[model samples]
Target: MPETPEIPDIPAQIPALREDPETEGTQDAAGTVSGEDGDRGTAEPEAEHGDAGFDLGEPGFDHSAPVVAESLVPESVRQVAARATLPFQAARADLSFGTAFWYNDLIETGGDHEVIRQYLVTATSRTLFEIGQWTLRGDLTDPEQPVDELVMGGFAKRWKVLEGLGVAVMPTVELHLHAERKGWRWDTQEITDGLAAQADDIAAIGAEPMPAYILGHEADDSGRSAHPDRTQRLLAGEVCRPAPDAPLTWSDPLPTGFDGAPVFAALPLPDEQLKLLCLGVALPGEGGPDAPATVVAFADLRPAIHALAPHRRRHWWQRG
Candidate 1:
C-alpha cells in the first residue's frame, strides 16, 4: 500500500500552535493567507478548538466597537451645550432678574407659625442642604455647572437688584466643594426681616420679601459607574448658573378666596407653564396702588441663584 500521509492532530496542537505566531499559519506548501476552513497553512483556519484572532467580534465580545457614552452625555448636558453656543447676553446692573404683580388685601389675622416653620423646614431641610453640597462638591462634577466667575458675576448683579428693592443687605453666599450633589441656597431671616421692616420701601418696589431660593440636585451616580470609559472630566472650581425654575413670580392679577379673603391667584406664565409663588406680606390696610397683594411671575431666576453666592461665585466643579 502507498505510504499514507499523517493528518497532524490540529485539535491537539491548537493550544501550543496558537501561542507560536511564526509557526501558527497552516501551509499548503505555498505560504499565504487563505479564508479556506480546512487549509492547514492558512493560520490553522482559526483553530477550531479556539478562535485565531482575539474575540474582537464574537457575539458580545467586541472589544473595539465604538463606545457610545450614554451616561457621560445626559439630557442636561445637551441643554447646557446648547446654551454655550448662544452669546451670554450682557447682563444689566439694574435690570430686575424678576418682576411681580399685586392685588389689594389685608394681612391674614395672624401668621401661621406652623405653616411657615413647616415650609422653612421642607424648603430648606438638611437633606436638601446635603444634596446641594454633594452636587456642587462631589467628584463627578456636572457639565451644566455654571463656573464660579459666572456664578459670582451673576450673583453680584442680582444682589444689587435686591439691594435696590430694599431687601436685606447682601447675605453671605458660599460654595460647597466636594460632587454627587451641587447647588445654591441661603438664609433669608436677616434679608427677609430687613425687607419686612422696610415695608414702605418694599411696597415701593411693588413686592414683599420671599424666600430667596432653594435649589438642589442629585447627580446620577449610576452614570459615574459602569461607564468609566465614557466619563467627562470637569475642571475643579466653583461654577454658577441660574437657579432651576428660578426668577420667582407672584403675578396672579386676579385673587380668589381660599378661607374668606381673596386668595392669591398665580396666573399661568406667558407660556402658561409655571406655578405662582405667593409670599405673604404684611401690607398697610390701604394697599399700595402700584403694589397689590397678589403673586408675581416673571422669568428672571438669576437673582435667587445669585443670592446664594453674593459677589463671589459659589460654583465649584471637581473631578475624580
Candidate 2:
C-alpha cells in the first residue's frame, strides 16, 4: 500500500485553552470549537474524559447547573442538526475531532418553533480546539498557520471550515485569544458577504485528499475495514441528513464525545444543500451532550464569532 501523504502531524502543543499574555485589552472571549455525538436523540456518556480544566459557557448563566443543549434544540429540527453535524478526527489513532452544526428550526416544524438561526457554532472544548487547529495546517491559503499572525490576522486560518460550510456572520471580529471559555450573543441580522461553499471546498484546501461529506461517515458497506483502493478517510457515523437543527445521532444513541460538536444547516441554500453551521452541541457551562443535551445557538455566540469573522475573510482586518 502507498504511504498516506496527507497524514496530519500529531499536534505538537496543547492549545492554550487558558489565556495568553499578548491577548490583553481583547475582552471578547471567543470560546471557539468541540462537541459529542447524536442520533437525533439523546446523548450518552462515553469513556470519561475531562475538558482539560475548562469552564462552562455564558456569563451569569449559572455555571452550577449544566445546560442541556438538546433542550434548546426543539425535536422538530433534530434530524437537520444530525445531518449537518460531523466529527473531525484523524484517519488513524485519533478518536474524534468534535462535531459542528449548521441549520435552523424551520425545516421540520414548519417555522413553528421560536428559534430561527442562520449562523454557525462549534463546541468550545480542548480536543475540538486542537481539531480546528489541525485544519489550520491544512489551509490552502497559508498552511504554515503562523500562530502569531493567526491571532493577529483576525483568526482567518481558524474560520476556513465554517466559511466553507456556508455559514453567515457579521463583519465584526470577536477576539477570544484570551477568552477562557465563554460566548456572546447578538441580535444584528447584517449578513457578512458569505464565503458559502461545500465541504468539498474544505477538503480541496487540505494537505492531502479529504472529503467534506454532507452527512455521516464514509462506509464501505461491505463490512470491511479499508477500501479496496486503500485510500479514503472515514468518519464514525451513518450516511444521511437529519431534520433542521436536529441532533447528530447514531445506532442506539448520540455519544458524549460529540458534546462540543458544531451544528450546521442547509436551509439557507435549499437547492445546493450546503452544510452550514448554526449552533454547537454543548457549551462549557451548558452541560454535557447527554439525555438532556445543552446546545448553544449560533446567535448566542455571534458576538464572539462576529469579532472572529474577519478571519473568515482576509487577514490584517479589524478586531472589532
For lDDT, the strongest prediction is 2
Candidate 2 yields a Cα-based lDDT of 0.26
On the 0 to 100 scale, the lDDT of residue 58 in model 1 is 24
Clashes of each: 43, 69
lDDT of each: 0.19, 0.26
TM-score of every candidate: 0.17, 0.26
Off by over 4 Å in 2: 1-83, 90-94, 102-120, 126-257, 261-291, 310-320
Top TM-score model:
2
Per-residue lDDT over 42-135 for candidate 2, one digit per residue giving the tens place of the 0 to 100 score: 1111101122221213111111111224233233233322333333332333333333333221111112111122333344342322323222
Residue-level lDDT of model 1, residues 1-37, one tens digit each, is 2221111112111222222243222322211211111
Give candidate 1's error at residue 12 in angstroms. Answer: 69
Residue 163's lDDT within candidate 1 is 24
- In model 2, what is the error at residue 160, expressed in angstroms? 10
> What lDDT, from 0 to 1, does candidate 1 have?
0.19
* TM-score of predicted structure 2: 0.26
